[model samples]
Target: MTPSRARRLLPPLALGSVAAAALTGCGPDPGEPWAGAYVNVTAYPYFDFGAAAAGQSHTVLGFVVADPEEPCTPSWGGYYGLEEAETTLRMGEQIAALREAGGDVVVSFGGAARDEPATACADPEALLGAYRQVLDRYEVPVADFDVELNDLQDPAANQRRAEAVARLQEERPAGTPLEVWLTLPVSPAGLSEDGEDVVAQMLAAGVDLAGVNVMTMNYGESRPDGQSMVEASAEAARAAHGQVRELWAAAGQELSEEQAWRRIGLTPMIGVNDVPGEVVDPEAAAALNAFAREQGVGRISYWSLNRDRPCTAEHGDPSEANDFCSGLEQEAGEFTRVLGQGFGD
Candidate 1:
């Protein structure tokens, strides 16, 4: 399982700030190269997406899944409905604040913890409507679907999601089209057969995919025994880059090598990974950032902003993967600072 899935299955844990106000929307242009970290909206110790950290101001707030009681309805981590989240979680305010700070957010759907709307709502129209609601509410230009675990193998769910997203795009007003990205699990070898199929389904369904952001962590046995995390992740990204180009070519859309890399994103699980003995330390993060910048990788994001802090005494053991803190010795926001370098240039 991916880190996000594993972390969610564990017991809940507790878990930003402003920049040059004049530079609002000064980050990468829409559909262009960008970087940010994931924020578990309903997680504890509410994160401020509006604040700038490490020269980066963009964020991907997510895992919005179907409401447990009402599958067709959208909820924040299945804990609060859209309206309730606005009032209780201050989601709207936070997003507004982030945008005001000249940053933007990508609302992610379908996470490991709960059923994505498409998985729960079988009706294509209903699924489309569910996705539309969230997109309209957030008014975001980008949406990420983090498909993993069993969801990756569910062909029916995958097809439904692809179709729904395609229709959602068509229905959007011109000049305000939505860019959909699939955030999938990857290993050093790159996308699994299921992951590739998911991409093919999206392309076949006519969804103008923005890119494939590989979760470059928790490689388990995929990482060569002696290779460092950075090396392994770099390998995984390179492999995925090739696969993405081939996949697009097979779909009748040929892209150059540079173009393929531009359509690729790398998101590592910062600090300790769910897999034992695998840790992305601060140095590793900086190396990964350097590699990304050198390769012109489109996006660089970590598993979470919530886990970016060091494990404090109150947070308990630093050896285990905790929900709130990264099980590593580092300053707060260290990963973001290191990984965000050169992004949004």
Candidate 2:
């Protein structure tokens, strides 16, 4: 979708202001010995084979499925899952590639696009059971899920879900960790000098969280501020940690107890869709990765490994879906390989 001329005028006008802001699957890619290091390279509806090859490690690397329905389920994310046969099969092909790489891929349970709060909220056991059913279907012990108060507040209900997962982890086998992804928006609505607004809730929910992913790339339809998305995200994670877990650090940058919660993960977008020849300077990507490293946060996920860039940034069109990422998707090719190099395996 194209942006109206009026909205186009807003960015330059507010340049000084600014703002910001999962899991599982598969085997590691073949090329390197990157094992056990967290990597999240994804596709909207499919994971590109080429992209996976570059991002995989012997350790940990996975995909956070986009859950976009009432209570969007990440494993169910993308337009392809519901298809009768053909499309679903195509999606499975991507899944197969992820598995072959020795990476653990997971479909994220929630995101900003999700609206339906946890219907199982009132009954803790029921929610856990329901989520478990998800595990049964995917054939994985746990799925990466996010917890924001909009759906899981009310301390009574909150504790139930938390207890369930914490129990699940303690009881489950050694390798399983219910990783989750949450956003720390530059939009002030979710972020703060301290990111406590949502952290308390997540911690209250459970223990043994494989990790947390804070999306610091700040391009949203609402486009709040034009500040440093990287900085805002790092701060939020630091503030989010409570008694249950400790903030490791930002994705590449390190932080202090006073600054922000150490994010468990970072998602750097490779221009969403790259400009034909722009090849978005690697320095920008490296700086973000480096920042996360400083924070002690070691994982990184790219927005996607699928989709083709059908347009160009020169279009001046304000983009309907947070245009910043409009150009990143493409057929498996050179761009995918280039984007995968940041892992430093």
Candidate 3:
């Protein structure tokens, strides 16, 4: 196993006793884990590279291409300012970013609309047919893709996606991971209500049975009335249909309320006011880090560095890239510590 990275000691702010209490007495125990962040290469590869280079551990990123031509072709997409033959150029660059930073990389597939038409995966069988090609391209045990029962909302489509995921899981050598992107709100009831009977449909289809990313930035509309940060996000996630049941099936034990979230997922994948009606909360961010540790969640990803922009609000002025960079740099260590690195820096 990789040695536990050193930890950080956060300087005290004018924290409330409650905040102090919140921060007190909890972190993952000896065997719990901490993972790094997912840098989205689509926005700015160089910047993404730089974030990994800073030594945060366990990076998961997507070099997604908005290339319409090879839409959903997995490894062979033909856009993103470079030609198709240059994929290794992309992967090689990402690999170097991690190796140089002492991190491991998981090549991601599917971004908002980057792989639309997903012509290659229109249905279950076609996707199974195309798996080997994607696997060979990324050369990683975990092949990442977004499969949401929320997206299609059609029961048949959800089932088709599930079967395809199951088939891929079966085909891959054991231990190879399959991660799905989930965009449900912080509560199952809200997700079920607004997401067109999400709970019933997904449970019936057996969708979301694999690992998940839980796409968690909410500018609002998608998030229902009172859910914003990841603690709420995680609570919402656990409340989903079949989640606890799925936990039972996967680990053969009932996940204590705390353990229902072991999937590699999203966290301060930061969002700011740029998300209309969205605001920032350092306290919530802290709670989120706390929540992940409490649940023994597997991995956490930030939806993007590009969206929140760090602006003067979170970091500094938009033009000064260092503002954005520094903010992440400052929080990264505390995040690492909260996520469960042994000692603090």
Candidate 4:
């Protein structure tokens, strides 16, 4: 989703917290099993934060933050501070609950609308410190970098991010390794030059990057008319697989097609995309799910869990990019049921 569009869809913040049962002890265990839909946390109320435990997702990728006020200082939804956000949104509690239920979270550091510490912080040492704080706070097994637009354009910031992460991995305790995932924008043609550069820099810095998760929606002018979103996404994945293979080889980590494809991830925007005429309905989701399983892709996720339901009559324009519903005909959790099948298996 576009940053401007995200700003419009998110609701105003209210300060508070809902008390719930919490899980004791938190730390990364490298042996933990993770798979299934990766739902974004901030898009709540629509998904009923507590109720989502019963859904198909085995992992929740919390929207942007480890420390909201570190380095350049970040905030949730451009409003509440990270503390208030956790208190009011019960994000930490949700993580505890998901973990108690045998699921976990991968805290994401950036998104379409926010400033991640990677670009905001100039000092590599301080950036590494910021990442360390986030890691220490959540003790998550994995973290994600969602780079887009201007962030993708800055080479220096990208390198700084890679260096910081490499340092973090180097300093990790003997048995626990924090896996990193680079989520980037894609078209039918595949990863852009900037996208490939991000991967190259990470490899050059010796960061143990788990893989690349391509955002396979909003093709804009790149997708041909009459082509299904499923077809477009499949073609994009194929293109990304090839690019990753060639880039890795250049970095002296030559990998076969199977190895390259296995390290690839697919994240299509659920339902109608930011661009019109690009809807990922149930049928399309099933096709993508089948393809993901066939390729043994590393991960399968969508833009959000909040937009997983059908738009109601009381709701406003379906094309307005509202975060509460899919703007398409789908029952609650139906999209997850269809798209998340066999994921993380």
Cα RMSD (Å) per model?
7.3, 10.9, 9.2, 9.2
Q: Decide which is better by TM-score, 1 or 3.
A: 1
- Lowest lDDT sum, 10 consecutive residues, model 4, at 10-19
Off by over 4 Å in 2: 1-75, 78-93, 116-122, 147-149, 152-160, 175-198, 219-263, 268-282, 307-325, 328-345
In angstroms, give how far residue 64 of model 2 lies from its true place. 9.4
Per-residue lDDT of model 4, residues 1-345, tens digit only: 433223235011111121011212221111222344545455534234545754333554545532435545544444445677678767678777776665566767777766667877887777777777667777877888888887888999999999988988888899888888898999999999999999999989998778898999989889998888999999999999999878777777766555565568788878777687888888888898778767656677776776788887655777766676778887877777766665532
For TM-score, the strongest prediction is 1
Write candidate 3's Cα lDDT for 1-345 as tens digits. Answer: 000011100111222222223222122211123354555444322344545334654455554432454433444233443344346336566566566666555555444433422333465555544554555555554445543323334455445544665565555566555543433333323244433343334334444343444555542565556766554465555554245435344433443333334433444444343345444345555666555544445555554433333234644453322313323323443434443232111
State the displacement of the C-alpha of residue 48, model 3, in Å, after optimal TM-score superposition. Answer: 4.5
Ranking of candidates on lDDT, top first: 1, 4, 3, 2
Give per-candidate clash totals: 7, 66, 9, 1
Whole-model Cα lDDT per candidate? 0.79, 0.38, 0.43, 0.70
lDDT (Cα, tens digit) per residue for candidate 1, span 111-197: 788887888888888788888899888898889999988788899999999999998899989898888889999999999999999
Top-down TM-score ranking:
1, 4, 3, 2
TM-score of decoy 4: 0.86
Estimate TM-scores for all models.
Answer: 0.89, 0.57, 0.63, 0.86
Error of 2 at 181 (Å): 5.4
